[model samples]
Target: MISTHLRLSALSLAMLAATPFAHAQTQTPRQSGDGAYLLETVEVQSSADASRDGLSQPFAGGQVAEGGQVGILGTQAVMDTPYSFTSYTELLIEDQQAASVGEILLNDPAVRVARGFGNYQQVYIVRGLPVFSDDMTYNGLYGLLPRQYLSSSFIERVQVFRGANTFLKGAAPGGSGLGGAVNVVPKRAPNDPMTQLTVGGQTGGHGHAAADIARRTDDGRFGIRLNAARRSGDMAIEGESSALSMAHIGVDYRGDALRVSADLGYQDHRVDGGQPNITIDGGVPIPDAPDATKSIGQSWTYSDSEDLFGTLRAEYDFASNVTGWAAFGARTSDESSIFANPTVTNVNGDYTASRFDTAREDTVVTGETGVRVRFDTGGIDHTVSLSGSVYDLESKNAYAFGAPAFSGNIYSPAPVALAPNTVPGGNLSDPGRTIHTYFQSVALADQLKMLDERLLVTLGVRYQRLKDYNYDYNTGNRDTNFSYDEDALTPTVGILYKLTPTVSMYANYIEGLQKGARAGNTAANVGQTLDPYETKQSELGVKYDGGRLGGSVAVYRSRKPVAGQDANNIFKIVDHQKNTGLELMAYGQITPTMTVLGGISFLDADVDGDKAIGAPETQANVNLEYRVPQWQDVTFDGRVIYTSSQYADAGNQQKVDAWTRLDLGARYLVPLANGTLLTLRGRVENVTGEDYWASSGGYPNAGYLTVGAPRTLLLSATFDF
Candidate 1:
């Protein structure tokens, strides 16, 4: 039904098409250097803050971007792209006072944040597909950033790419993000020097302080940017406290024909008295959601993690129409935690929990190289690109859990001291090697533009290989060596036709790859490593750009293989999942003083023999900002997030009712003495303090629920020097 309507809209646009012979002065929609590009026309703009590369341009809405990276194909204007994506700029991040990755994701309607399996890691669900934090890329390089928690201060932009991206980014070593990907762009030095200091506080006495400084050489040939922040205080939820610190430094050099950049960072985070997830047993009916502020986690339990990482990149132009680039990155992380998670036993909110301790260490190295060339053949413009990338990750982990179960209640939490463990996992203090994963891929693509560049077609394919290994816990000995030396070819096709200067129709077919698993020690075919499986997605969409207003409609269908155990208890990849969805999105300035941004997704998800778990049927979000016409120095903003009922059990027996949340915010800018500017911002989230289970079942073969955060009030002030 959605496709039929989309065709009608495209047909209407086609009927009003004009001649293709239009102005050649407009900038090209395509990009190079993996979405990083040189400046466009230097025409002066009226805005005080204007970026030549469009990284900070907020279309008409002043909240989201008009274009972003399309994986290996580089960046493209939103109207010309065949895929669905949204880029959130730094201006919006700071205005919302978002401190973590999870907080930043609240602006997207297509994305929902959930908790990782039995841990504090944040998980993002897009189009009913789960993408773990480990799959997030930093400046297009994987495994170089922190795996669990990352401060928003380290990032300049958040680009959300929805749909399968195997041909663009290659197979993720973590074997997640099959449906989508999030690429974080690091902060860069601005042409003008900037130094700013900020201070903030939240509902539960949480305090925050951060400083940002950036400077470019007199000739603007060399630049440096630095960011440092600290956060410590009680969280919105009762009894919970948080401590976090981070430091980041970046440097870059620009020459006539070459460019180089590097980034280094460190982060330390800890949490105490934080609320945890609850696992639901099959036989018992699911319990009602408890109060949002109730926390059962022991006061003595805590979680801590630290990470150190760096990356280097270079891009050089060999000819007027040719460019080459390379990049490399590495990360070392250490973490230890002692926490307790509860599990529901009955419908009356009865539950039980235990304390578990663990330690982990990780070393990762990732890099990529590529080349691009542009030419013309008899009036037809052609762009060809070739690239190769690799990711290697090794994890050393150990854990101990020997304490007896402690009784608890979901409605009324009872935090009790746990008996010390009698038996501890070998050397939990110094974890041993546990897992090693490696991935590599090579991709080639060609874009053909004909009919005065009104029609664009792109074809590409990637050859990918994966190798995963597992070792015995505490001991460095290899237990199951899953040496999958096999490789797969994933192809992609995309087409875009410009019916007019402001309207376009596009379609894309792409494939996704996931690492196949090996037989466990108890399986009949133990140690048998299987070849990687593939998933496919086909999408059709149309976009319209009205200068100050924009919108898009997309319909897609995808199928992916699911891993499970057979009746004989043998592990294997046997079944497939089919997902069909319709998405409608809108953004930009609806008027001179008011702007709107939002989208809605309707999904139909089904497994081979059962219903898909954890995914809701309908999800939507809307954000609005209006400037006070009378009080020109003040602005008002509001946002609402809604999710329909979702199944928490595979059989679809337990379900959650649809819920909606409202957030309100305001900002005032004042001109101070000495040409200085001061800004005051305040926000209230979850104004009603609603009690609900926000999400469920991120991990495979289990249905666990995570509670929503309590009502929160945030206030902050910034001084520009």
Candidate 2:
């Protein structure tokens, strides 16, 4: 089945590529008034082009975009939309030498990075809620990118949407994303021919190399791009090593009435002797962090994954003011890992760990189709959109546990003999199906413009159906008692008013939907499935765009239902967690030679009249770049990240210390006589070499500590021909 899908995707790419050339060849030269032959002008536009509905143009400093996609509503300028969003540009990705999407997101103050439970997968914390890495979307399609990690070489833009968004996109398959959503746009061929190569290395003898090549047809209607990169060797942490290889191909076509794009990508990543998360016992105090450069994981432990994914999208203009679009994407991924996360029993850091091995395979297929129309009614302008989407996933998994727990100290390490596997589930070599999920949704939205287009009002709703099935791990038999089938409706309302040419005021009320929890076997109503849970949010903000500088100030409040067993031993939705926050962001050129991008977040999270675990009160970031006046080719950049102290447990009995980090970088550009350019970049992260816990928890109600990276150096050189 996977091979058949791949063949169909390849055939579609071939047909799309052949159509533009054939159309170009059929055109003939025209005779001008002077009886001279002249070629017709061809207007070309790629997915990278900046427009109202396409990718937004970079702001004054070239680090962030002026706006980004607002779900089914397409793209809208930041000031014209009620929600808060930030689009990081490819320039920023290159300048920072970011290796993954998580690294690129470090500049966002509203976000923090954590690790998956007992594994190496990256997890993002937004507005006191978790958004799993697998939940992120690519080009507005879900479950198409690598699950554990994402390579940055083929990414063009990373867009962050704040607040509940089920009405805009759909219910996330991972059952998260109540706080925010993330969407990544893939790279596309530009207007000009290009060939570039880059080589770099970091601390601990790591080496890297990458290549990017692009070209377009003579008529400028067809374009293709290819990107590949590899990295290998030891990491900054002691005794830790990793290897990563990735490749991507992109093809696109642009015409007067139609536009199409296709992309395919592959990635293989492995990590050995990587540091593991720490879990403390309930009565034990949170221990002090160990050396930043040290690793606590066993040398025999490792994690690895391989992924293949692709997407195809097309857009057509039915008329000057009406449009329709569709997109399809699929992914197949395999992962295997051996983990030994420690549980500290005392303040002395003495811990016990046992080996746990697991394997998983995931296959995902998702697609969406929509149409939009523009018309006038009684002197008011209206833009109406209708969209439908579907997603399906099949997951196979197996696991084994070793006998006899090993002992170790956080400050001192000891090696122990490998233990024998005493318990197992399914076959590790050939796992059977364990979970199946299916989701379908239909959405409709209409935007009304009044008062000479100064006031905008948006009304939207989505009806979603969710189905999940679980199977016995050992026997591969269906478990009807643990299955669920449910449906729900999510709605949104937003209003924006332009006070002036440079300022705007906006407000919105939105909801996020998630699958309800099934009663546990110990509960009175075992196996009973409740209705879908709805997370509600309300926000108000003001935006300022001064051509060279842009900023926004917003305040929002959200409530998420919590399910648990009541006093009567009946499982039900009993309580809620309420989160309120204020965000202030500033970006763009502060002066002709200086650029700044950063923000601060203040959050108040409460559940059952206590502070929520891992939710900090204050988080802030400030990044600055300055160009040397004496040498126009020289640039210096620096950043400061600060996080306030937070509790490690729900009871607020254990607290993690506050921490700060500094990073510095410099780059120089050289121009050659042959029209080629060379760029050299050098950076130092964690310059102070501070030892601290970067984050406390990622999974719900579980506080696991992830150590911060040590001081590391990165150097790179790029040549363009």
How would you encode candidate 1's per-residue C-alpha lDDT over 286-360 as one tens digit per residue? 666788875767787788989999999887879988988898999999998887888888898887878888899
RMSD of each: 8.5, 7.8
Candidate 2 lDDT, 279-390, residue by residue in tens:
9889788889988788898888899999999999888889989999999999999999888889999999999999999999999999999999999999899999999999
TM-scores, all models, native as reference: 0.91, 0.93
Q: After superposition, how far is residue 43 of candidate 1 from its true place, in Å?
A: 5.5
**What stretches of model 1 exceed 4 Å from their correct place?**
1-56, 481-483, 520-523, 567-570
Q: Which 10 residues in a row give candidate 1 its minimum summed lDDT? A: 14-23
Q: What's the lDDT for candidate 2?
A: 0.86
Winner by lDDT: 2
